[model samples]
Target: MNFVYEKMMGGKKGLTGFLILATLILVIFPLFLDIFRLNLVGKYLTYAFPAVSLVLLWGYGGILSLGQGVFFGLGGYGMAMFLKLEASSVENTKIQSTPGIPDFMDWNQLTSLPWFWEPFNSLTLTILAILILPAAFAYIIGAAMFKRRVGGVYFAIITQVIAVILTILIVGQQGYTGGINGITDLRTLNGWDITTDSAKYIFYFINVALLLGVILLSRLILTSKFGSLLLAIRDKEDRVRFSGYDVSNFKIFIFCFSALISSIGGAMFTLQVGFMSPSFVGIVPSIEMVIFAAVGGRMSLIGAVYGTLLINFGKTAFSESFPELWLFLMGGLFISVVMFFPNGLAGLWDDYGHYITDRFSKSKKTKEDSPEIVEKKSDESAA
Candidate 1:
């Protein structure tokens, strides 16, 4: 029990923070917000998946990937393909020249489903693809770069370039990828209509549950020996490499793990948003994801979720009101966070929260001791 508490929960303080966050999303938000707002929060939480992944990858492992959207888009597209196929049944798509293919494919004059898309006909295959494909792709990328000892700004630039390239590829391959519009008109999942409010509520709960599970899993990893090694590699790669450890392998594993997490977010995003698009697969969204982690404090997994929620909420509110100025505001917010609060909200809490608590504690102690001290002094004078 002690071992589990220490290792899995990060002791008392970690457990307290986790419970507070869980209560906020699970109890507070659901109770206060309406369905539409709650659903929007669910969408924001989907983005949190990648944010949390960044906490592990960039924060701990020191592997900064600016191309997480690639994994995200892949996962979303995998699910979208299945849903689109299900929605594009022969009976439903009979009006199209190519019946049973995606609408975009028919419009593009593709007579048959692509070979790569055939497996998505089955839900099992789709799920497997969402789970495995991103990690596999990450493995290829990680091994190529890390094994070659390529990192730092070069790696970051390479990831950004990959994001750009993928966005272009998806946009260019209109027939295969649904083009710039992306895979749209996603209607159902395994014959269950996902357009209803009930469905949104259900998906929201499921997403929250999965997100909490991911956080716990990540916390477990960070508390383990392997996590310690990741930090060592991040701080002193040469020394760790010289100590007989294969540093590249650790980076590769974490990179793949982060990709897997981001892909889960992508899949959930498709379900919630009812579509996938190249807009989400491009450089801007990828950078926004990193900003979510940065604003929340990269070292703190739970903080990542809050950071995602805060930034997205601000985006929605600011965009709704200011519209034209939101982008500039967002840019300024990021600048401020980077310049003054580099450690993020979590860091601020760590730095000042204790002082507040300590002040209160001292005051309380002084109040309790006043009566006793006065009584002791009076007794001595009387004697």
Candidate 2:
């Protein structure tokens, strides 16, 4: 069960050498790169975090969860709750002012509080809830669906439909979810001085660290037996069951893990951006997240992150230069990637590895063939 893929010419080639080389490049780039670019990259990294989950659950586990945005929304709203409370109309208020509550809550004649939203006013409680809420929902849904052997487009369709329903429900419930306008224009976070550039960079660095941590954690899982079971269930659910594995359990586990990761990403996103709204966790953004993984390379976790970062880079670039062409430009970019590169940007690494190997081989052969000539020339030069 070695991971080595057999070489075309002879024995297997090692994956370790490639990984080490990649690690060196990653470590060095940040040291020399511009801080502004790193900050921009930091923003994209949070988005990529959820895309990593998309790769694992959709790319490997065969679960096309269109509701990943909901988990993200949970985290964003969680942080927003704390930020809103910190931005309360009155200072040191004993009665926690409800945050993220639509202004219509007063219009709807809500004189008192909703029991469910009470914990949101507490920073500690909100953060914990942000992590838990999405995970619990995903676990329930995954348990129900996978146990029944649901797979393919049906699962995808159901998830998408659920996303649409949730978005509409949030919109309709103007009292709680902030309706259409969505929560915006927030100022403080956990009493941290968000206005300061140094403080912002601290948050940015935290996101970068988290993004790398998630990738490493994903690699560990993907190289484990659990990952193998996930792929097996993805490719052939019935076969996995026939092999005596509880396929449902594996699917639920991955689904929940995806939710948890997505929640963290969502929370950090709001924590940094200082706002949350129904539109963010809505259907379109959810679909965009899926595209990020698909275009990046469904099977590669790093591809997902790189794809997201590159896309966001293009967005910033395009939006700044030719604002009118932004939509068409982005669309064309996705179309090009989809049509031309099935393995996405990660294929560049594979191509470069082969190129380097070929060049090294040719150089070694030249040295072997011309050893006498080389040595004679060297001696002559020395003399």
Candidate 3:
């Protein structure tokens, strides 16, 4: 009883600290920033949303999901569809048409409205679909895959194939989906005109706050006993099964939750950028999401956030300052980390703190051996 009580107390304290610090940063975030910096942080937060989810599903639950982009796309495309419809003429009400769409539909030689496109014309339905479609897909997929004991690479491949197929299908349905262009030319979202600079800033803050919420939520789940069961299932599912625990149920739970997180990220993404392209949800993008969480040291939540910030920051800086060679520059950066630091940037953080502590401990030893000389050596090493 005492152990449980103490654990609960610790959990509450930790969660409180996290919320306080996160709130502090966000509240003061706008004060110390130019619009450009604010916008960048917002973009970072948007990316961080999925990073949080991946850290849970892959990091804590030991489920490597490559089809995260599918959920992301669902949210994005769902929101985009709503925003597009909101911009259309209500008098026509049925296929009022978009600049990107009506023209393409005309070009594709389709005279009448597409049936599937009708539901997207309503904002409430789109918002509901934004949350529902991805989750429903996740549930079905999770149910089938988990119940059959399908996991690891087979699950990974199945997800990857889904992403590839979805992208191809979107491309093939040019008139309906805008083809290779995917979904862009979004003029507004909700009732607000997304064109104003202030609107952009507000949107950025909204994304950041949402990202922070996800981080806190994931942390809560990890600190709970549920997290313990997840890790057990990951490391030794058969043993867990022998112990009378249902591994499949836990796996599905995590998968579905992660899908919801990805969906939210996608929704924020479309709101901020006003674009939802197949490129953002293709096989490569799916793999990139995995690489992101992997680079963050899949075991650590802080690692996920750190890795995301590092990668996105590097991309932004290199692209802006050295447009011609940014790709090479970013590739070199990742390679350096992967080669020298096998566990990733998160591993580096742990190793770095360990190095510092070791240094101090060694210095203390040397100080006892030769008090005067130890200071010089310590100073040199610290530098």
RMSD of each: 5.4, 6.4, 8.6
Residue lDDT tens for model 3, 44-97: 666666777888898878788888888888888888777765654444234534
- Put down candidate 1 lDDT per residue, 192-302, tens digits, no spaces: 999999999999999999999999999999998999999999999999999999999999999999999999999999999899999998899999999999999999999
| Highest TM-score against the true fold, candidate | 1
Please report the candidate that would top lDDT against the real structure: 1
Error of model 3, residue 2, in angstroms = 13
Off by over 4 Å in 3: 1-29, 90-103, 106-113, 348-383
What lDDT does model 3 reach? 0.76
Give TM per candidate: 0.92, 0.81, 0.80
Which parts of model 2 have CA positions greater than 4 angstroms off? 1-39, 92-109, 354-383
Please give the lDDT score for candidate 1: 0.92
Shift of residue 157 alpha carbon in model 1, Å = 0.9
List lDDT for all candidates, in order: 0.92, 0.75, 0.76
Sorted by lDDT, highest first, which candidate order results? 1, 3, 2
Give the range of the ten consecutive residues with the poorest summed lDDT in model 2.
Answer: 5-14
